[model samples]
Target: MSDRSATAVVLGGSVAGMLTARALASVGVRVTLVERDALPEGPEPRKGLPQARHVHQLWSGGAQAMEELLPGVTTRLREAGAHRLPITTDMVGLSPRGWYRRWTESHFMLLCSRDLLDATIRAQVLADPRIELVERAEVLGLDGTGSAVTGVLLRAHDDTRRTLRAELVVDATGRGSRTPHWLAELGLPGPEVREVDSGVAYASRIYRAPEAARDGFPVVNIQPAPRTGGPGRGGVLLPIEDGRWLVTLFGTRGGEPAATTADFDSYAREQLRHPILADLIGQAEPLTEVAFTRTTANRRHLYERMSAWPENFVVLGDALAAFNPIYGHGMSVAAQAAVALRESVEEFGWGTPGLARRLQKAVARPARAAWDLAIGMDVFYPGATEKGPTRAERLVAAYVDRLTYTATGNGRVARAVTDVMSLERGAGVLLTPSMLLAAAVGPLKPALGGPPLTGDELKRAGLQ
Candidate 1:
């Protein structure tokens, strides 16, 4: 139980903000969430989240954490038309080495439009009586010196300015967060930062799924091979709600996908390493114009390594680290970080000395794991970093490449890889003695010549 009545102010009202609010409220903290825009009352797009039009998946690790935070949320998502896809069983993927055979289910993912996912979670989080939401309110700055954060200054929609004092303040303002500047205003030194930008651009569009394929369709993906030493291109056909398919195509630097709808199909078919995504979507009816974005960069703020820190200020979600959406780990990492926040508050009790620093370090554990997974491949792209991948990064990438190649023809190896990809297990699982031995033995079977889609899937998609 908490030592006393405590109040917390959470900045931003997106997934990260709402989840953090719920976590804080769960532990007897009165939370006030401030948002710059008016939040929608239903499952609709908001001006703040432009990337919601593209593909988004919540892996099992995140799903479990969400369920723990808000009971029965998964059921609500399903009732609203979200699909729970089994890991490799419902995935037809082409890796750089070759097509990966569909293996038995090891984990799962929740697939739906980003708007629906966000709205569902937001609705649940805001229903708590202890959590208050302040919409159309802009956060001006942190109110305190470098040693301790006292509260925040805010300007309301009516141009009224005031300060909201709280025992704790949290920043969940996504990638555009001004946390670094806010801290600097308080005379605090900024944390070390690292960025790996692949110059990847994404173009996505929605399509009405074919009649027979609407109920159950596998996700189709074609991955780019960085070893080719040129441009990298890829595409994914994600079956979303409303019997629709969200097709997203991406390329780095020289091979970026065009913004015109006329070229969407050709880019998927001819530009990617495989043509499965194009063939599947070629016959489907297009439903929306292409939505393109170029904000796909992997960045991390080393807050845990800072020599000095504030007493009651913490940063979470993309405000702390933002990864390329291609890996689909952003939402998952946010949920896990929220869980870490809850655990830290419960363990140390709110307002305890050094609680903020402990929570920051705890949350970074999951973020760091997801960071390594994303940069493992992103760092190899041409012009991704100021300097090329360091020697250690190169060595680690080579080992991971071997594991990926072996996963194509080995079921055990594939499960091990998915364990890490699902965010259910840490990367240490791959370094086990048994896994090392399996990699040494190499793949037990020959590489697949083509995508391992079942006959029914092919027939339904009109590819047969």
Candidate 2:
């Protein structure tokens, strides 16, 4: 713990902000979490977070960090009706190459409604006496020069404006963050930014699972083959809490999912690379109308590359880097970033010189990994980037394509791929000499004829 009684302010009350508050409170810092919306009292939706209606999963890598941060968050989530799904084993996924075989479990994911996940974390973090929650508050700008951020200017629910001083200020305000504008006001150079938008739109709906399949149904996914030369389309059927399946279908540009309810089923069956999601969902009962969004883009602010970063200020989560949600890396990356924040504060001590700059660089490690993973595939789609993928991206994509094909039939190769996908290991793990040799050798087993759904699963879904 630090020797001084420092104060910090975190903007945004989402997962990233809550986790940051928890981290700071644990180290004896008094944290004030400011939110633009009045948070829900339970697992209810908030007005600010429209994306909660879609499917989400916390991969094992992020789950581990959450556990480390909150100690029993995984248990809390499971107790609140979340499912622990073993990767590969309990996931029926169709990769760009072919159907991925259900190899033994090397990693796992936590599946639940985003509302439930956020509510659980919120309750746990707000319980800390050192943290304060300021609801219906909007941030106007930073309150300092380019050399150091002293605090924030905020307005409460009544539109009363005031300045709140702090030893540190963190931005967790998601993709709409005005950090760039705020920094400009402070006379600091704006960070370099990159965006890769696939022009993808998502349509999601909730359905009551078939009676027999509610208890142990596996997640089913059909991914698009971007190299096929047409608009890429895909769908995922995630079994979430309350015996309901959260199904989301997404497509790029000309092939986007329809916003109408009647068209949801047809799009899943016809637009996806496979009919597995359609077949399974057809047996279930629709519980909600389709919720659609077109914010599937990969954007990153290269803060670490900035020549001059303000002290006592840092940005995390979607405010720093937002990825295409289909890859399910956003939440995981945020949790990992929180861990990085904690480690940096512990190593450098609060208010230390250049501590904010050091922390920004530390969190970027996990963000960079997820950013590359998302863009590697998304950049292949039409209109994804202003200029098509660069030469380096093309080369990396080619190598990754080979690895994916090899993973379809080779158990070892599959595990290696998941190691990175799970965010458990860095991308360097896939480029090792041994991994290169395995990819060169190709898959060891024969290709699966179709989705490897077991007879039991087929029967449960009434498809046998």
Candidate 3:
């Protein structure tokens, strides 16, 4: 660890911010985490995190990164009731191409409510003496010029305002970040932004699983066929902690799910391409009202592409790029970016002249991978962008569509696809010569006739 006595002020105390604080503290940086709301002491809901009610899973790619940042945290999450689910193996999904065969596990995901995931990480991060929590404090703005940010201007709940100085400042605030305005106030040029809005609305609810099917239940997903040119509708039933299933139903623009209890079951039963999710939830009992959100736009602020960046400042997580939650890449990308943040700081030393810029560029790698995966499909939605997907995006989507079809009948191809989907590998893996040849030959085996649920599973869920 460097003995430079580096200090950092990380804005926002969500998953990204907490992971970032933990990362910096690992390198001996004293970190102050600023949050707009008081964090909960346990795995309970907190204000301002409406998305916590929705389905959240930490992919193995991210789980590994989180483990590196906070050792033994994964075991803690498991101890707290988070489910360790192996991908493809623990998944019963109907893809646009066909039903995906449940192959041997290539990766895994940690399933639980967002609240539990956040609280678990928060507990571990706060236990470190190097990090301090500044709750119920609002960040007014940066306190320096375009060339450098020396501190943050903060307002307490009592309306008292003061500037807190630090050698480094990181913005881990989510999609609602005001970094663009903050940068402009510092006389910096605004970063270019790209947004692809599918106009997708989400309605999620929790269900107490049927006693016999509560544990070891597979995650069921009904993916929409976006190429059909109709309003895409999809649903996912994730078996979370406490023997509960978190189900989220979503539809693009015209076919959006209603935020009412009465319409929830109907949409799941009839609107999606498959009714497996509905069938699974049919034997369960509702535990919570529908939590709805329309903030699923794919937005990216190209801070790395900016001609100039302020020193001692960096941005990470959703502040850099926010994806449609349906893809489940946001949290994984944030975890990967936090790892990048730490590695970059270590490589260049915390106070290096261009360290902040290097960090910004480094974090963008994982964000770009996830952005491509999300927008590749979302851009096909009607009115997603003023101009439809670019020629490149269309071409890539076509190839990916073929790859998905091949994956359904090819275990090797499925592993490669999941490698990228789990954020464990890059999209370039799909373009390898072997992969291309495999896609060309198409599925080596026949497509699955239906979801590969065992007889016992069917009986347990009362779907037999």
Candidate 4:
């Protein structure tokens, strides 16, 4: 109740945390971002964020949001050697039924090392005069009740914990967030939780792209065929900054990829739906040792859906839900959710009662979209979860399969899919009467016989 303006504490230094700080900081709120680890000085490796070892993308939809939150960030990334890859046009992927031909470009993506992404956003967020970062500061819990959270307690570098009073606290600590436990401590029950894990394991390594493909290589992806009655296996070659290609090979329970050098190339050649990745990488130089994780899962904490929730607190990003990273929607969803946070705060006054609840609920709209898109195929892959898809899941999967098949030949259908995936539009837009009619009418063009690589592209890739 001091005369000074209210303060906010953001827990965790993940992408979500930085973006949350951006939203609040932009609104002139004083923010203290608490991180337990020493952030890297540049776009380099950090021990705490192991997921940085995988393929990461900022989809056009998410890129737009990030741009709005931190102006000129895209330019900064590109100047730092990050490639802005146009979708469909710059990507070659093997869909479930067949190879997906490159359609007319509808969206673009930002490809770079996750380290670069984190560093770039961290710099912009911290640049805000209203925000401050406290390294090696770990959050303990909250100070107020179930209806309204007041502040957060911090454990400094010396392990001495002190209360930092605030009018608000945002939980962006990502998948490992203790928000649920914190809520329980305030006498509020933990929210409903749901998890569907396909027992997916990820293995990623950096490759020095060939001189020809260094600056302009297409993003090559061989997506898993979930309907093939076995564990899903997939691979991607992402062109990142500094002449590097971040290649990741992953598989579900019965068909997992390995982390060791002994097993990496074999899985690259034998397991994936296509041999193109292995063929391409055969001549490339390996830059980093393979890194592995079995932590890919769809976990959701339904905090907003709770009948009673606290004010002055909202959980965004991976704290609210963490989708399977293979989908590459995590960063986009985080960006869009951050947009919702900005919108909600503006719609309602910053300190208004129920502002947190409204923002939390709004953020879930994007989370639900990401979750549905992820679990749609994941639930069908063998050993992806404890059980198979529900009856409703099967129906939805059938429809999506038809749509994917249609999209291979129909540009409009492809655009509709991109519209939703880009986070520019909702999935409901796809279910409109016109889209349903288009789906029923079938594709206007024939399915492509092979990938859409041109003669020049082939020559450039050294395939000629």
Model 1, CA-based lDDT: 0.92
Error of 3 at 63 (Å): 0.6
Candidate 1 Cα outliers beyond 4 Å, as residue runs: none
Candidate 4 lDDT trough over 10 residues, lowest sum? 1-10
Q: Candidate 3 regions off by >4 Å?
A: none
Candidate 1 on 117-172: residue-level lDDT in tens? Answer: 99999999999999999999999999998999999999999999999999999999
Measured against the true structure, the TM-scores of the candidates, in listed sequence, are 0.99, 0.99, 0.99, 0.97
lDDT, candidates in the order shown: 0.92, 0.92, 0.92, 0.86
The alpha-carbon root-mean-square deviation between model 3 and the true structure, to one decimal in Å, is: 0.9
Residue-level lDDT tens digits of model 3 in 1-464: 56667799999999999999999999899999999998899988989888878888888899999999999999998998889989899899999999999998899999998988998999999999999999999999999999999999999999999999999999998988999999999988899999999999999999999998889999999998877777889999999989999999999978899999989999998888877887888889999999999988999999999998999999989999999998998888999999999999888876889988999999999999999899989998888999988899888899999999999999999999999999999988999999999999999999888889999999988887
- Per-residue CA lDDT of model 2 for 1-464, tens digit only, reads 65778999999999999998998888889999999999999999988788899989999999998888898889999998999999899989899898999999999999999999999999999999999999999999999999999999999889899999999999999999999999999998888999999889999999999999997899899998887667999999899988999999999877999999878888987778888888888899998889999987899999989999999999999999999999999999999999999998999987789899999999999999999999999998999888888999989999999999999999998999999999999899999999999989998888888998999999999899
- lDDT at 123, model 1: 94
Count of clashing residue pairs in every prediction: 0, 0, 0, 2
* Residue-by-residue lDDT tens digits, candidate 4, 230-326: 8889999999999998999999889999789868899988888778888777878999899998887899999888988988888889988998998
